[model samples]
Target: MTDIRHRYRKLVYLTWFLTLDLIMFGAFVRLTDSGLGCPDWPGCYGKLTPLGAGAHIEQAYQAMPYGPVSWGKAWIEMIHRYVGAALGMLIIAIVWMAWRHRHALGHSARLALFTLLAVCVQGAFGAWTVTHKLMPLIVTTHLLGGMSVLALMTWLAARENPGPPVLLSTRRWRPWLIGAFLLLTIQIGLGGWVSTNYAALACMDFPQCHGQWIPDMDLHGGFSLFRALGELPSGEMISQAALTAIHWVHRNMAFLVFLILGSVAWKLRADPVLRRPATGVLLLLLAQLVTGLTTIFFQWPLLIAVLHNGGAAGLVLCCVTLLVRLSRKSTVPQGIQYDKHRHPGSRLAPAPISGTD
Candidate 1:
């Protein structure tokens, strides 16, 4: 049992680190605008890395020095791809480990398998995201998929560690907390879409859009969510209004999500087990808000932008972990046993009427 526990813990730590690496690679992909730099799935210009296709990359860069196929862009895209592959390999290993030690880890084998399947689908969407020229919908799904992978790995890690079961008093809030976490996940997805579409500065002001509370929003054209990769349904290029709409929705949703999560945090503060995570959520929320505002006010500093995304991901993980912990029934202490004498309820006939009795 001890050996199994140690192995599970090690796997959990490894998955956690790999998940973080995946997140960093994701950031790099977005920052360099290399979502389509490779223009191929599982390879860069038909090779595994940029170095493998040095001649092609050189020609492309020489053809257009400022184009998306530049050396830096290729490297960024290639690195992201490599990291993604590494994550995939790690997930495969996790699944294998779970299967090999199914009895020791109890229910984690199934969860590990699910994660493996999820990452496979995520990889598909990633390919589609690039192949389709970063279609807004596909891109958004791809971003959320990465986050889901992170959340799943985090959940797996927690299950392996299995912290002290939450008290019954706290368990009652678990469902609501889970709901809040899901809502935040969706909001984060929208934020990702906004960022991927380069719509972060669409509004350029808080509490208003272009000096007006609502500015003239072309919702019909702007939010034609079923449009093509880069072209609108009307066969026209996607307009700034569409970008503004995406940005506006994400920005406005941030405020509502903040209120909801803040309320949850406040409610959970009394429980010591929950207090630490509650405080963490609050701190990350504040940091996200600041980075978000600073991005707009400072013309979208790269570092702040990346940090905002990372903070959002971290917040989601923390919320999900807290929810999972709070959902379990608290365990009784070792010394506690069924004894009618201790309770003195009188109505209860506890335990067996022993032969000695």
Candidate 2:
């Protein structure tokens, strides 16, 4: 049982890291405008790899030089697909091992199975992203789906190694903790919308957009979800005002996120079991602020934009870890003896949770 547990832990850890990488790579594909490089599903130009599709790629390039379909971009998009495919296979193995060891693994097996389901759905979104011609709604949903996979993997990995249980007293913090998580999720969705619509640069100036605290905006058009990439449902091209609305909403929401997460971090810092993730949330919040402002000041440099995306993922991971830790039930037997000199302020065990970070 110990050996099986160790092996499963190693596998879960690997999958978690790979999922994180895939999220960042997915960002890279979107940021580089390579989402449509292949212009097909699963395979590049209807072939398994870009190598065999070279002629088609060349033809497309010749048709429109500096277009989305080029040798470099096809490779980037194909590599993203290949990595996603490999991650899916790894997830399958995880489900298999989890089911095989379900008796000892307990709830983690189910979590692993659910992770498999999520990856499959994410794969569907990936296909629709291309087939739908990169529609803003579909692409944003795909982005959220990728983050969902990362969060689930983080939770599953956290369960692999049990830690000193969180105290019952910490239950009072649940509302605030969960609220912080919800706020972050919504902010991420808005950020996705901004990216999908190329609205990051809609308001090139920070704190004030277009030299106004509240610029002219089309709230209804900006948030209409049933339109094409840059068109309204009426088949009219979207205006700059609509894009400005998207960016403005996302920016204003950032201030709220900062407030809620800052408060949550302060609350969690008082708990020894949750301090690590608290610090993580604080640091990531600051990083998001920095990268977000620099993205505007510097005109959205590739590295800064990608890092901003990554910081969001990191925040999701931290939030999940905190939730998992807080959900643990204390297993200390009644009347258990404690060595006060060696283990201070601990009623159950001396060590804190292992995966809080």
Candidate 3:
């Protein structure tokens, strides 16, 4: 059982790193405008490989010279899909291993299985992202789904920690930590919306938008949530006011999230188990803030913009790890309170001596 635990634990870590890499690559695909490169899903232009789609790629370019289709873009899109498919296979293996050792490993297996489900759902979102023509809502949801998968995998990995879980309630600030994590997640979603809607440069200036603090914005159109990539549901081009609304809201929310995370980091620094993750949280936040500023002031450079997405994903991973490390609950099944007694190494005192004599 111990050997099984160890092997599965290692697999979880590998899957985690791969998941993170996949996320960064997906961001690269999006930032580079390669999202529609293939103009198809799973396969590239009705073939298993992009090279096989040469004629179709050429036709696309010929039809719309500078549109989303290109040989390079097709390759990038296909590569992202391939990596994602590989990750999915890894997750399936995780489920199989978890099921094989379900009894011995307890909830660890359950966590792995749950991750499998999330990956499946995420794959669906990926398909939708392409078929729906990069609809802003779908694209943003796809980004959120990826971040959620990262969080799940991180938490599952923490479940296999060598030591006993260090529940958050032990400290007086557990609620604050949880709140900060949730706030950060919401902020990340807002950031995703801003990105998918192409609203990052809507304001072109920091502190003030369009040379005025709080330029007029259309929150209604900005947050419709059911619209396509660059237009309202009415098929009208999205107004500048709406894009400003998306960017403006995202920018202001960052301050609130920053304050929440900053306070949480300060609290975590005092605990040794928490200090490392705390430092991670702080550094990611700082880097994300810097990258965000550069994206705005410098007119959204590709490298910095993509790195901003990566930083956001990293922040999510750190939060999930911190929460799982601190919380007693595991994604593993155990009827809420883990019955450590059933597992080996459990030191539950023997049932009181029976007096049947």
TM-score of each: 0.89, 0.93, 0.89
Q: Write the residue-wise lDDT of candidate 1 on 264-325 in tens digits.
A: 88777756557888888999999999999999999888888888889988897788778767
* Candidate 3 clashing pairs, residues 3+ apart or interchain: 107-332, 168-326
Q: Write down the lDDT that model 1 would get.
A: 0.78
Q: What are the runs in model 3 whose C-alpha is more than 4 Å off?
A: 164-170, 329-357
Of the two candidates 1 and 2, the one with more favorable lDDT, higher being better, is: 2
Mark the 10 consecutive residues where model 1 has the least summed lDDT: 346-355
What lDDT is reached at residue 108 by model 3? 69
The candidate that wins on lDDT is: 2
TM-score leaderboard ranking: 2, 3, 1
Off-target runs (Cα >4 Å) in candidate 2 are 331-357
lDDT of each: 0.78, 0.90, 0.84
Give the CA lDDT, 0 to 100, for residue 24 in model 2. Answer: 96
Per-residue C-alpha lDDT of model 2 across residues 238-277, encoded as one tens digit per residue: 9999999999999999999999988888888767668899
Per-candidate count of clashing residue pairs (backbone under 3 Å): 0, 0, 2
The segments of candidate 1 whose C-alpha lies over 4 angstroms from its true place after superposition are 331-357
Residue 278 of model 3: what lDDT? 83
Alpha carbon lDDT of residue 118, candidate 3?
90
